[model samples]
Target: MAQSSDIEWTDATWNPVTGCTKIGRGCDNCYAERFAERWRGIAGHPYEQGFDLTLWPSRLMQPEAWKKPRMIFVNSMSDLFHKEVERAFIDQVFDVMERVDWHVYQVLTKRSSLMRAYLHKRYGSSAVPSHIWLGVSVEDEQHKGRIDHLKQVNSDARFISFEPLLSPLHAIDLRGIAWAIVGGESGPRARPMQEAWVHQIRDACERDSVAFFFKQWGGARPKSGGRLLDGEEWNGFPWQIVPKSIIEQLSL
Candidate 1:
């Protein structure tokens, strides 16, 4: 499925792959899994098989059809690095991203190590495509290693998503990261996020010159708590890596 997204960070979503297993606390209340499961058993439905590992070879060309440029959140419904997804299939996904240079594809994943290994093998000391942004989902201090894994990649378009911020991320380094997005978990079983935790990351970003974006504060629903941090909204973005041509088009 490919369409405009309600996600605050990106303009659209492209799910050439679907379904994933939980790897950590962050996956406990996955909105994507919940949404996909609801349509299970429905005849001819896109999610008829529910949140099972499935690939859409047909949807591989969706982005090429979108003439206008966009910020697409790749695989919002699944992880591109899931063990079930074959390496050859991943090549196809990257191939599409490589071909479609107009759009900015944000590929965020909890499997940071897997993604790092894949990129190392694919690009091998060369930089990844500038428009295809690589990022890792970090929930707390325990997953700090994911950031390190991201830093090892050969790309300038690197970012980190701290959504469902589970605990205080004290003293974590942000030097090599280009962008950071922080938010609390939402939904019925949502976990509470502390003010200090948000500050910890935001301050680190400021000190290290990384872009910081505050997505939400978490509650029964995604927007149950408005996105605010200390009486202000943080909407930092990294525009330094955008190519000159795309920047001109974006201004239009």
Candidate 2:
């Protein structure tokens, strides 16, 4: 079963794999790492590696058991495309996704190069499952190259996550993108996110007519900060990709 997530971009989280190590500045204060340490004593805890690279093959079939259609965050506690995760394990993960066509899986990773290489060698362009929405994490200008790499992937739905946003990104080219999710970092040592940064992305999305979702205000504690920009919440998605038939079916 998929666990309902507080993350504004998705409905639920399904960690077929868990545990990851810091790979970039955006990972300086990982919420998943902190959560793992706090719940170390719990049974069946997926984050047993305590921020160390580890894979949990036992969780691969969890989505198959889910009856309803859901937007599942794949590997929320870990990066499925991490270097430590073997190619065989990735195949198993893809196998589960292939079988469970009812659920929409959102897989985001910082390892865009590895992802590109894997997709090219293993699945190629035609093999990217339509139900899977692939995305890359671009926290700063240095990581902006990830956008280009993500564009090369053969996935049907491609997106970008600018969460824990560290700097103002200007002239973002949303050429072949489907959606963009922006949010500030939130934690005890969370960094401050500027209002101008949020507006810049929002404005770009408006101009390009790309789907934009504002996730949070991220402060010392995200809950205390809340997810309000100007006065309302921005939870929009690209309606074009989301078929009208599915919309009608969901409405019923």
Candidate 3:
């Protein structure tokens, strides 16, 4: 089954792969790891392995059963590009996505370089399908290089998630980007995000003609700080990249 998500940006979550190891400070308080660890040692639980990297080939065809078109966040529980995930498994995931072309799949990852390399090898000079949107996660200025990696991909549906915006990305370039989602950390060890940091990216998006969406002001809880930014909500989306067929079905 495609898990329905509470996340504001996407409609559902599909986890063909689960579990990941930390490679950066952004992974310190990962929400996926936190949730999965709770079920450790519990028999019959999906996360019984407690965040140990595992692949579920059974779930690859899960999306094919869903009739209605929607935005599906691929691998919400783990990164598809994680080094441990086999290239064959990743190919299976992509195959399912290509076959079930009705839903828009958002494949986000912090492993930007690996993702770029894989996409280049898979599609080569050909354009990636519009139904599959590729994106990378950027937590701070130090990791802004991920954006450059994302730009190297040959896809029109490119995006970036600036969640847990830890530092100011002053004068950051947003060219060749279709959308950006900004939000603060939300958990027990949640770090504070400065308003000045958000303005920099929002302004850059405006200047670059990229759609910007402010997810939350995250606190102890996901909604502890509310979604308002400068007295209004920012819920921008890139409708241009969405396939016309999906858009038409969504309206119904």
Candidate 4:
């Protein structure tokens, strides 16, 4: 599916890939897997395969058709770097982003090591395109290495999604990160997030000059608890890292 998105950090979503297998704690209650599984066995349903990791070659050019320039979150329903996804397919996805150049793409994944390797092989000595912002998901301190992997990639618009923030991440090093989005889990079994934990991350981002975005203090529903952090919303965006050309286009 390629259309507008409700994700606070992005303007739209383009999923050339769909369905995914759980990789870590953050994925324990994946909203994607849950939603996909609901359509299992219902022939004709997009997720009839039931979160079985399917690729859609037909949707590769979805971004190009939308002439408008906006921040698009690539593969929101799946991980592009999943081991099952062919490297050739990943190349095509990258090619579309390159050709579309006008729209900004945010490619976030929990498969950090593989992502780093792919970036190295694709861009090599050259820097990654600024419009293609690369990011990783960090659920807690245990997955902090994902951040380290993100830092290793040679991209100016590197970001961290501390979503489903299960625990404190005070030790995370936000040095090379341009932006950080923090939010709690939301669903039937949504976990509660401590105020102290969020404050710590926001404080760290401030100290490092990193743009911080506090998405939600999620509960039963995404907006159940509201998105206020200490009486104010943390909507810091990494506008400084946006590509000059894309920024100009958006301004127009």
Candidate 5:
């Protein structure tokens, strides 16, 4: 069963895969890694291996069990497009999404290279399923290239997640993007997010008329930090209608 996620951007989570190795600074203090270690004692625990890039074939069909429509975050605990994930397994994950067309799956990946390569090999120029929204995580200026990589994929909708925001990003070319989600880091040993960073992104989204969602003000305790910006929370979605054209190509 999919659990309702605390993540404000999406409604539910489906972890067809779990556990992943650190590939960037965003992985330095992964909540998934911490959670896995906390549950290490459980017998045959999926994350008992603790962020070792494990896959759960049993979880592949979870979306099919859900009868109602939902906005699902695919692999909340891991990256579905991780290099270690086999192509056949990726196909199986997609199989479920294609079969359970009632739900909208939002797949976010830090490894945009793998995602782009896989999509090209599998779908080519054909349209991506309208129910599936693809996204890439960009925590800092260095990771911005992931956005360019995401543009190459053929998903019906494409977006970016700039959570745990570390540094300021300038001249953000939201040219081909559908949505933009921004947030600060949270938890003990947490990083501080400057107000300027949040506003910069907000302004960019406004200029491009892209949908912007502000996730949280992550500090040592996100609950205490809250997600308010300039006095209020920004929770917005990109698509107003189904089967809309990808936004980056539009001239603002």
Candidate 6:
């Protein structure tokens, strides 16, 4: 995984586990799958097995090695809650995240139900650590239930990503969410995102007081169309959720 990421949101990516199966329409043109497949069958390559669920137990301690605090995106190339992953393994990943403490980890997944169940089991009635911000991906209205699942979790740092935004998510409720990222699909077969669809989300974020971030206006490439929305770039972040210690270190 890269120590630095080009992603506008997080600072770096740490893939303690890699590879995942497609769970929905959002996975149709997965950039992670495309990147991993390119290294398929190449001996000694991290993704030699392609986008097949593989656990990297050795990488569990990667975050601890980094002394500096940063915003780390966990499992960017995979979904940590994939059904194929064992409960014990998931525990190890969480264990590391909890112990590391210094870094803020963004664990995003499309497997909303599984994540909700696991978090309930792991933390019981207590809230998850604020440093470990949990989130879900909602590509359209059909997947709006994911947001509901996220809200059910016992945390105030919940967020949602509407990237590769396929269809209009009309009048979605963003009440419990702290942050929302919206963007169009980017790839060879990228789908066009209507301005009205984005306006709906941005306006709702304002209404619900959720931090809104407009990632990109996707095309053949991520930045091809630019990130301008109403002639301005929206890069809102949930700084309120980040711990004070991390904020102090970041400023240093």
Compared to the true structure, candidate 4 yields what TM-score? 0.97
> Candidate 6 on 26-126: residue-level lDDT in tens?
99999999999999999998889998889998899999988999999999999999999999999999999999999999999999999999999999999
Q: How well does each candidate superpose onto the true structure, as a TM-score?
A: 0.97, 0.92, 0.98, 0.97, 0.92, 0.98
In model 3, what lDDT does residue 118 have?
93
> Could you give candidate 2's per-residue lDDT for residues 133-230 as a string of tens digits?
88999998788999999989886588899988999987888777889999899899998889999999899888877788998888878767788899
lDDT of 5: 0.82
Per-residue alpha-carbon lDDT of model 1 for 1-252, expressed as tens digits?
A: 456778888888899999999998889999888899999999999999999989999999999998878888999999999988999999999999998899888999999999999999999989999999999999988888999999999989999999889989877999989999999999889999999999999999999999999999989999999997889898998999776668666521
Ranking by lDDT: 6, 3, 1, 4, 5, 2
What number of backbone clashes does candidate 1 have, counting pairs of residues 3 or more apart or in separate chains?
0
Clashing pairs in 4: none
Residues 109-172, candidate 3: write the lDDT tens digits: 9999999999999999898999999999999878999999999999999999998888898669
- Model 2 clash count equals 0
Whole-model Cα lDDT of every candidate shown, in order? 0.91, 0.82, 0.92, 0.90, 0.82, 0.92
Tens-digit lDDT string for candidate 5 (1-252): 456777777778898788888888888888888878886756786666766677788888887776656778999889999888899999999988887877778899999999999888888889688778889999999998998999888764898999879999989888778899988888787898899999999999998888889888888776668878999978787656343333332211
lDDT of 1 at 185: 95
Model 6: residue 131 alpha-carbon error in angstroms: 0.3
**Which RMSD values do the candidates have, in order?**
1.2, 2.2, 1.1, 1.4, 4.5, 1.2
Q: Per-residue lDDT for 224 in model 5?
A: 65
The clash numbers for all candidates, in the given order, read 0, 0, 0, 0, 3, 0
Give lDDT for model 3: 0.92
lDDT of 4 by residue, 102-149 (tens): 999999999999999999999997999889999999999889889889
